[model samples]
Target: MMPLRLLAALRRMLCLCLLAGPALAASPTGWPTPYTQVSGTSVDWLKTKGWWPLTVAWQPAFAGQNATVVALKANALLSRRGLDARFVPMASGVAVNAAISDGSAQLGAGGNFPLTQLVDQGAPIRVIAITAPNLKHQVIVPTASPIQSLSDFKGMQPPATIGLVLGSSAEFYFQAAAATHGLKLGRDVVLKNVSQDEQRRLPAELAAVVPWDPTATQITTDLKSGRAIDVSYPYNVYQGSFFVREALVRDVPDVALAITEALVEAELWLRLNPALAADVMAGQPELRHFSRPLLAQQLAEYNLLYKLSYLYPLGAFWGRQNTDIAMWLFVQGKLGKPLQGADYAARFADGPMTQVFDRLGWKIPARPPYIPADFWMNFVGNTLPAYDTYLTMKGPQAWPEPGDLTKPFSFAGKVHTP
Candidate 1:
């Protein structure tokens, strides 16, 4: 024998080296860096997937995601569900729209603004589900500000610095709301795009943030700790939907249905296991903006929102997308009239939306939800809060009536805001 002691030492070294290899490959230090190999080799199996194997193009703002976890767990879910799919990550709605048109991805998630843009572009996609009308508008005033109601905005200035998740479906609702209330953002009041982390400071000047999400916990905590308060109504009723390419609606409707089934199941799972669901969802890097309590509240809110309109609202495809919003925004001048009538439905395939209801053995209700909250919001929390879609304005019993075609009213060839 070479030497018993030396042989034992060599074996231990080999074991140590084996353990060290993966740690080195993982790059325990650095900014989510790409995995590196110890030396030049035929292949680096450890880093084969690379960073963010996702499509990198269609990056929809998730309510909350543990994308990393979803990435790790998704394939198994798809496999078990018999979904022959790939996560094809894309960075923007523009890219997602292109992918669907080019046949790269059959479906993707996005907000109403982009979908509105898609209709204008004449892209071949359509709405599959109305996830939830955004509840993002918030008139966040510090526990100590003088701004009590919309009237307090008299001398306010822009850059009011309200916290918001940039580029979400909530944008549309805010646009509609500000106009409805005669409040001109970036003018009358400012839209402050601040991160969730920075919000703890409770900036100096904040009239109210639009599409604000302050759950009952946040509300109660704010009351106790004296943080933000309800300057605006609690609900955001802008309609938003889950849309997909039209071809998939017909060709591979089952795949669409399968995905919808996952969403339905995920929604239920979140409802039943809230804290755990938040734990999983928090793992998603994109949705890290929210706190644990906020995330939990969102899961419950989404679960209730989706189940409200119809048992499975997605399956209720009327062969037409809701373009009334487009018309409304166009008149308001926030958008251009891209397309009109039933022709707008050409943007998507309906097989997935329809088949999902069939697969689940649930009934899809009649007519697409003109306003999702009408069916859903009433059932969301223990005591539902009032919404912002339609507000009652004071009539002749109010102000001194001043009539003037000269300046009081002039058609800007569009709907006037103030």
Candidate 2:
């Protein structure tokens, strides 16, 4: 018997799917018809389990997540692949997590902090794929500020107040950088929770603002008033993950694989059509204020590490990073109890991504391609493989668009127009 909450969610899902039937039918690829098999999972097995329309809770504030949403909205991948889904945009990871917790959404996309919190609270959630592994964050100060670096915060008469969307991956980066420089929150510095708009203003009261791109880009490039001191690369390996309810992986495994494949295709489309992708992002209300060129820059930076040959892997190091974050949060009293990486290690579902890469004819990496330590040391003596090696590892899909990033980079049986 299904729980009452889940039953209600299913009913809502069916209603939404019914309303979206016309759109699905109108899709250029058409809706996914009954395939005998998809990614080794029986199509019949999937239908019997009641996996129809899915509600994805995604935050549009982040660049990569926003692009993926734009791709999903354009029916770039989901509909043709037999996954009937609607995307509900959330303001932040907290809202996405809430939607997932209440069963309103089956899959949620968020950064490391939110994913870690979900696992720490013992939600029946498992991370399925890496959406944006190299997502960047920054600590920026006003142009006139006396502060030159993270080290400047030490021994101030009055503790400096830092601004950020608290409890976010920005906070995670700030914390890591602060500790590296021996600065402690509340003693050496104070934190003031600021919204995205507040960060943009670069308020005089706050000594520095920690934000993710294109917000960071906007502050530095668009506004030209803030200068970033410490970026994400050397401080933290900022990552975005798509996590699904454990039941989805357990029952409708094929659906999970389709979701992962759709993400890969969507990102590929994004990489191929960055200008158009930026236009799509600028179409969003919150992003309307940002210029098209700035948006494109954000897209390029976010997609730098995403490779078709390697795709994104949910491997050992990613698990270890999450664990380290969870432990750090717990030690900082952000979480009520101690939680290790092992606590959530079983939640990482890498097989579906492996299958997607297999179909793409790309090499499946044993772990994520880059880490903070690798960036810190410039990869001179790192044991891990470098980005150049991954870039050269392309398969059937790697193309050099004559003018456009290798001729609009083909995928899913059609040349992308926008």
Candidate 3:
């Protein structure tokens, strides 16, 4: 009884629905069903698997980087390619390391300090890329406190106690700074491990709080009662690394490559659209309460230091820096023994990162000459007698000479041995 035109329309509609049925059925809950097929990419693999989920362990503190990843997910970049990506928030780098260790997440980003600590502790993880460098940490004191500089700590009665998160870069820098000034960590001062919130509530007796951004800025801006005494020892060259489980890097390289590409693309997008990226980050649920201007300011600061263009060079440099940090830790008595440059390099998997850059036609810059230990010591303007003494004991042969970064210095299986 239906008209000929209506009958034909009904047939077309039924055919279209039938064609979409499999895609709809294959898509997991809350994921878009791709109508068009993608080929020869990570997304294609996701489509083949019916849009399986990929989990990334994330820290909220890495705002700009976090924003880019979130943007990728929100835009259905992965879904369109036939996969779902999720970011799971973690409290600290330690938590991220634990999650990766237990197989709860495959990818994570964290400061070089904790990452180095974990690697030295024998976690089967590898840093795939150095995403950013020059992250700042500050030592702050109550505006009225008598402790004006590092010199005040020497031979002070009742030894000063500085509040900081243990195993954090803040702690590492604090120890380094104290050592440079001839102050023994346990004997000269007390390091009380405190949370960010606890840092604000530090009693009158506490000497200072050593914290990284947001918390560092918050102490000065929001509290208005704190003053930054000194920036961390390294001063504008500390790094943050993107890490993956060793098994993932070894077993499924494609997934690691895809992640590196995604990160690089996200970083590029952020750079090209800074204002939009800042606004987008401000709207994130975790960051919504923060002022848009504040978020934007933080974004600007991050953009200045971290550039996707220098990814490879930065990774190579940080690989060497990580060993330097390990040696510093050893001299501080925190680490059992020094880590050699080669063992540090072994923890870095550069294959996936190089592949991503190649696919994008990005040129990897020539590696920079290695900065010797004495260079950093002079740069910080603090003579580390203990560190100097330790090097003296090891002799010149054990030290990595300038321009020798390319050659891997052997540990000869002596790592972590007391």
Candidate 4:
């Protein structure tokens, strides 16, 4: 060698260049080799026989409800469970719905309105599980505005302009509220399309805006600039749903089950560690606009509204809610044609979630419960006691049994250490 020290430095530089070349040039089409084994299957089988790195479209628009996405990004859930999946951040359920329909994403999570729209389009999709119900969407007004309720907008001189993303669940909620208060779109108030972020600061000309949390939460609590005149509940159930392609469910049952288990476990993890989950969400670029304290509040609100359950409640309450929304949208001219909730409910692929519950040794409801026709008149508090009874209870109630949510929960015989 010319010099021992120089020769060693040259070797180190060569190694650095070699590593940098691949990193700069590599465009990965598949997950790395030697995939972790899940349910006796590996990425070897997935690549050769099944779909590898299943593309999951998750919406940050849902805020804290999408903690599962946050966990997946941190490689805390799906990777830990040996599931080869990629989490794609989407702007809203609207985008997620399109991804699922176009075959870009095999799995997606969306709210009631987008899900209904996707089903109405006759896409090859299925509702696998309910993500959450009673997610609060509200009609918010600036603190200085004189309008105290939706009724105040009725018969305005120029028809107050309400800001909201058109054809969104926010619109769905606003419409329901308008109808109840004897106001109609274009009659009492006009529409101005605005993103949820824009809704955080009500524009000068806009009278009010409709946005779901944590935008709504931020507007009302964190920013303290707006107050909600009306809310989604008692008008719309507003269930956020997790849906998948029928082909994925039919072809790769193991993959589907693993994904569901990961999601359920992620939710449990959020329940046990709301603060940590909030911190994770704050780190996401899409959600960076929201502070950790606000996210913590959103998670707290979610944990308060719904309990952890992966199984789809396929009873009349759910059926009628779905049907009612579909019918309403159809009549509102938002949909091309009318659709029965049963038309899509028939496709509720509960197999994966069912397996998750079975593995946990939890009692699964054998039959869907029936709800009286009038129970929906006051649907908020009118649900039957046994119909998804675990949902309303606090602190993560285990179905038909009590569990210690204070302790760590496990899946696949592995306790969640994080």
Candidate 5:
């Protein structure tokens, strides 16, 4: 019962892979045994779905929605490159892990943090690629807010009301910033989850806001309206990418390779097609009124963050930050247990990502003005990724209604929940 669009996309990808795969360079990793060939518009693979033989790409771009990027990538690869593949949608990082583990999904994106968590817990998930790494999730408040510094929250006094997601990278840094300045939540400040309607108003009612998943593109109206202002997180605390079960990888690594190639093309399209990027952002009713150009701006900024992380530090993400960030989280008791630096990063597969970047000759960018605010975290703060949304900033993109995750047999296949 997957969305028709999703089913169509998966069918398209599989056909492309089957058709184009044989022409691909030597598998280097070899292909799965007993592969079958088909040339129909739809797949007969799922007719008897007890872990049907298939490769699926279920990574979420930007704010973790599928169907958009996956569909676009799947179609392009199928028509132009002949990659017979399937792109599936999952609801979350947790869901992606589950699908791959359960065989409903062969592969999905899980990012460094989540991958690290699951791997440390001993799940069979393995990293096949790095969609993004070294991206710092920033913390932002209103540009004109009275909150002077990261440590100023200590004065908010009993039940201080601020806004941010409780378990995200934003909270990780907020906690770090507080500790660095000797501030404590519950004793000094408290967090309030904001609704879309309340986002523009939250800055006005609260001392300041630290939105991990902010709705507004920037603090322009909030601050211009004399509501509040904006500040940015100095560094990121949580990191995430594509994960697949080790068994699937062992059985069919070419699917992983093809997916990596398709994603590279997709990311390139997203980066270069700023004026139309929103076309690939997928459906999220909540983002209906959000400006496409603004989302594009956020995506560009997020991608640039990736460039910074990739270029400035370890030269590649390689999950080092995962160790640092996870270590910080564990010490703060955000995570259940302590994980070793080596153990945490062991889950990342930067080789694939690095291969893609190297093939493209990409390097960390020079400076900030290199991108624009709307194209960066100047809006929703750090939670917004820095990829380029292909859209004209002047026009607004209507939000598409997302599939109900609660339903059965959704396009998520056995993997929709991811």
Candidate 6:
């Protein structure tokens, strides 16, 4: 007494099974075949689900700073390992963060500024690893212009406009430079929201452009009139981080671990073979617009490192720097308020990355102490008084400590619950 609907459904399933044949019987139960292998190693849990062709979002810049190299090599590494993944180029870090936030992308890579902003605003993502530090961001002016330094832009007869993308690290550093020169943003000088493309056509009225490479390199190299005046900040160790959605970390941690391992390997490869790495990065479709020489020049400027042993010295400085930037944003009314130490801990998850290091038997490096308050005060310019007062009130709680991987993933001594 089988129901007519049930019988029809059964018949269709039978036909499908018959067509599928012995291949169906031999096939693994749930997960997609040949997509979960990692460097020729396979994990049983990775075979429990069918997540294939992992999507990574990245910002395509001629500068080898973004995860372009890592993403490119990771695809090949995974393919060699029998997994499949691809990196989708987004317009900017903001777009990449949005893509991960909306679940369109499982992972992303970018500078700490936009990524931190997204996490502060409750994006369902966590920074799993810090790939590199000390990326060069500069303020460049035409060689023939009277604006030789940041101070020269102050009190011009006609207000000068600097071209920079809004909500970027360039804007932050530009504001810092103006503050240092006793000038206020929007009053002493104006800022125009210009994209990388628009920067090439910089107007006569534009005093300078604050940009990260390869735009910075391209402009300075192509225009004989261009001269780089100043680097954005002194402790110019701003970092690039890898971010993944919580869902991916929660559901497919092995996949996350595998990707992290692949990236670490890729980083080591890039460091060992800069020439080959440059060639590989330049070959990417997003970067084919630029010449190989430009790509090599940009690559020369970058110092990418991912070894767990190097994390402490770099992470300590970067954590303090990140907190300072966050405080600056809050004071400027860009952020609602300064985020707490626990909040930063929740944003950065070092466990998965540490596990990879442990698996490889790499020794963890010693943790470096936080940078003194005065050093930060000098770095932030005229905001010293306000920053000093804020620090006194909050204590040193917001500054992150070098995480103890042996215990758990914690920042500023609090466990990261997320």
- Can you tell me which runs of candidate 2 are displaced by over 4 Å? 1-52, 309-311, 371-418
Off by over 4 Å in 4: 1-51, 310-317, 365-418
Alpha carbon RMSD to native, model 2: 13.3
Model 1 agreement with the true structure over 262-362: per-residue lDDT tens digits? 55444434444567666765665655545666665655554333332332333223222335456655766756563464545555444554554443223
Clashing pairs in 6: 143-225
A best-first ranking of the candidates according to their lDDT comes to 2, 4, 3, 6, 5, 1
lDDT of each: 0.44, 0.69, 0.62, 0.67, 0.46, 0.61
Give one digit per residue, the lDDT tens place, for model 2 in 1-418: 8899999989976765554333222212211333213443545554454444678888767776777778777753666776667788788888988888777788888888887888778787778777665676889999888889999999886999999987777877788778878897778998889998789999889999998877888998988999988776654566687888777777777877877877766776676576778888878775676888887776665554444433454546666656657777887788877666566676678778777654433555554444323532463321222333222434222332232221122244543211
Which candidate has the highest lDDT of all?
Answer: 2
lDDT of 3: 0.62
In order of listing, the candidates' clash counts read: 35, 4, 0, 0, 56, 1
Best-performing candidate as measured by TM-score: 4
lDDT of 6 by residue, 1-418 (tens): 9999999989976764554333311111111134335432233333343345667787767254453445445347555445576767787888887888787777787787886687578988877766444456778887787777778777775678889988888888778767777776766689899887677655677888887777776777855557788775352446677787776567666666666666655544454466766677666788766667777655544433222343322334455557867887788788877865456667776667777655433445443222344554453434332221111333322211234233222222333211
Q: What lDDT is reached at residue 166 by model 1?
A: 51
Q: What overall lDDT, based on C-alpha atoms, would model 1 receive against the true structure? A: 0.44
Ranking by TM-score: 4, 2, 6, 3, 5, 1
lDDT of 5 by residue, 131-212 (tens): 4432333344556666666576665655567676555555666666666566677778777765324545555556655543
Candidate 3 lDDT score at position 20 = 36
lDDT of 2 at 169: 78
How well does model 6 score by local distance difference test?
A: 0.61
